[model samples]
Target: MSLLVLLFAVIPITEMLAVRLFSGIITDGPGQFAANPLRVVWQIVVFFLALAVTRSAHHLIKIVRVRVFRSGFQAAGSGVPPNKESWQWAVAFEMSNVSSAVVQIAMFAALFFAFDPITGIVGAVVAAASLAAISWLYQRQLRLQRDYLETRWTPEAVAIPDRVGTRIKHSEIGAFVGTAGLLVTLIVVFARVLGGQIVTSDAIVLFLGLRLMFGQFGTLSSGAMRFARAAVHL
Candidate 1:
């Protein structure tokens, strides 16, 4: 609940204020915001709405995850058949991931399309590249989850460290890339505003690098090798 408040209320409000003050940098000119205050407001509102929807979807996914585990436990008690929790988990995980991707697409479109047509074209490419990386990571994780669930190994026989990764460590890679991209983009944006400079190739490179890094990180896991092919994805 507190996290939701932080995400939907504090963060959006803070970011909106910052964007309003610095909209010139983000959108390419003072004229952009000057002519479109309502558009900026609507974009911020939509961003926060997307965040809320993402959080809600996460909660639904968690419920499905719990249900899968419960099914497994019930199967164990009944001795009627092998539990199908593994398959259920995989399905639910993938669905959750897809939901997240949808949110990102919506948010990205809102922000990217706000710019002029030329800048929007570049923004669209950069956003798509980032999303493609995330999709690749998710696909790998889905495969890993399938492997783990079908494996002959039992949870009791495996250590926690052995179960942590079946997919790539995309988040860490994304964090690194995202941080770098954010830094470069921030500099370019501010330089354009404060110094009257134009967009540069370096910004485009930074965006692409960030996308590639995120893709690599999202699919790579730490402990995939320890488990057999039948084990669950991390």
Candidate 2:
């Protein structure tokens, strides 16, 4: 609840005030504020509303993650039928992922026809890229969860780690790739922004989304090794 308040209320109000102050410092502050106070008020309200919706989306994602992990931890492979919790968790994860993708498409299509078509088109790509990153994270979680279940139920499932790859940790590989990707993304974004090709907040957000998408690609390394493939059901 406190986090919700911080995201929806405190942050929005503070941001609006800061923007207003900066706007005032450069030009007419009282004149604009006096002319249409409602416009300023509406902007703040919209900012807060957007943040609140994002927070809710993230909360739902967390619920799905927890359920998947919990069920995976309790799963046993004794040649018996899977329990309801495990089955439900697997189905729910898949359905939620598909639903999220569908909703994103529907939203982008509706918004494109209704509002700014160009921005909406870019938004659709960004949305797809964002979902890809989320899927990447989910894959990592799924691998860990699968291993947790197998290590307990089927000792044979746990394969020996390759000594060759053991020299450098997975975290090192991820960090190397993610850092390089972040640098490349920042350079590209800054170059475009400096060249005046990208304007508007939406464009900025889209570029950053691409950054995250590239960063998440680093996780593919975890699924590359033979031992990793055998253990994680990848």
Candidate 3:
């Protein structure tokens, strides 16, 4: 378990380092490299080293996950038909997803905070707010749907609950609205860069960081939802 955690933590740090190196190369140009050839070579070597470590970590994580699943399967009586195979896989996947999301969020937040405290705080707040809203709504919907499923499976089936349908519609609307907000944020950031309110290189790095951070947020959200569902099944 400690090894697994270390692997998960290492991935995000290496990924962040790789991104910073690549971004520096793009922003600083060849002139800087020409001035310090050794420094440029060192950066290039470090970038590839980070990439290699990231890849190796990913491969090892998969192996660890498989071993974990197999161990659990054997302990649960492997010859008993493995009826919940899909559920097992789903649970395992969500477990890894949650771990990866958590590590990525912490790494990204630290990176941002190291660069600019205000940006870090704002990013954290946005992530927390978005997560809280979506999680509450999703959990409520899951409960309603679970209840509806149980009812349907009974000897005397009833119609689906109106609350479940309403919640689903609301969730869909929220998703679209969230997407629109993301687009608007991107546009505003671009405008700020153009207006010289933000440095071009800073804007690029910020955008890249934000993109990665939000992606992990989405993964965390979905993983939590599915993990909850898997729990219900259990």
Candidate 4:
């Protein structure tokens, strides 16, 4: 929910981990010692720059979502009741934009600046493909929303009572977090044994966890919003 946390805490921590991870696997001879100070400084600068870019994008997406949702409402006619579910979907769709863009930027930045790849071509291809995927999803969602608006679809009436699903167990949250921890452990272990990088690989794995958790957060919050909306009928 707070973009600032991602910008300040998650972004920097992940990037620093990237820097450390790459510095190990992709060595540039003994001169690395002399250049480490500069490298560290440059990474700090890049982190701040990335943070700025991500923060701006995050805020911009929110504004766009708000305007687009309001426009859809107006297009549907002011007399119609709010379709809160549709607006909620719009928010999730737009947040995916931020999430995907951040991943692309962060990954490519890591490839180019932090870790030297096995081959230049490999790095280039991966970065391009990853970013393309992100862009494609971002555009696809926009088009979907546009199509939805152009056709002004109405929400079907429901007779179900407005109540939260009693089936959702409280342990689901613990299960989710526990799964995230397992993933981090697996990633770190593989990076160490296969890649032979300790500190850096661990950092990379942690960053992976952060991104995954952010995504899970979005999904969980969206479900919670649906429950709240259903409760409104009460």
Leading candidate by lDDT: 3
- Candidate 3: which stretches are off by over 4 Å? 72-81, 154-199
lDDT of 4 by residue, 1-234 (tens): 344224323443444444444444344424554767676556556656655665665566556655655666567664534666555454555444445445543443344333333322333343345434434433443443344444444563222231123113322442344345445434544554467653454445434533443343334333443333333322
| Tens digits of lDDT, candidate 1, 132-224 | 555555456556556556663875343445546423244454444434434444454445445644344323433433343323223222212
In the range 1-234, model 3's lDDT, one tens digit per residue, is 567788877877787778778788788859788798888888889999998998999899988878877777778775533677777677778888778777777777677665556566666666666657667766775786577557777865545566435654645644543344345446656666777766666677777777776666556655666666665565
TM-score list, all predictions: 0.42, 0.41, 0.75, 0.42
Q: After superposition, how far is residue 180 of candidate 3 from its true place, in Å?
A: 6.6
Per-model C-alpha lDDT, please?
0.43, 0.45, 0.69, 0.43
The candidate, 1 or 4, that scores higher on lDDT is 4
RMSD of 1: 9.8
Model 2 off-target regions past 4 Å? Answer: 1-35, 65-168, 200-234
Candidate No. with top TM-score: 3
- TM-score: the better of candidates 1 and 3: 3
Clashing pairs in 3: none
Alpha-carbon runs more than 4 Å astray in model 1: 1-101, 115-119, 154-159, 166-168, 194-234
Native-referenced Cα lDDT, model 3: 0.69
> Rank by TM-score, descending?
3, 1, 4, 2
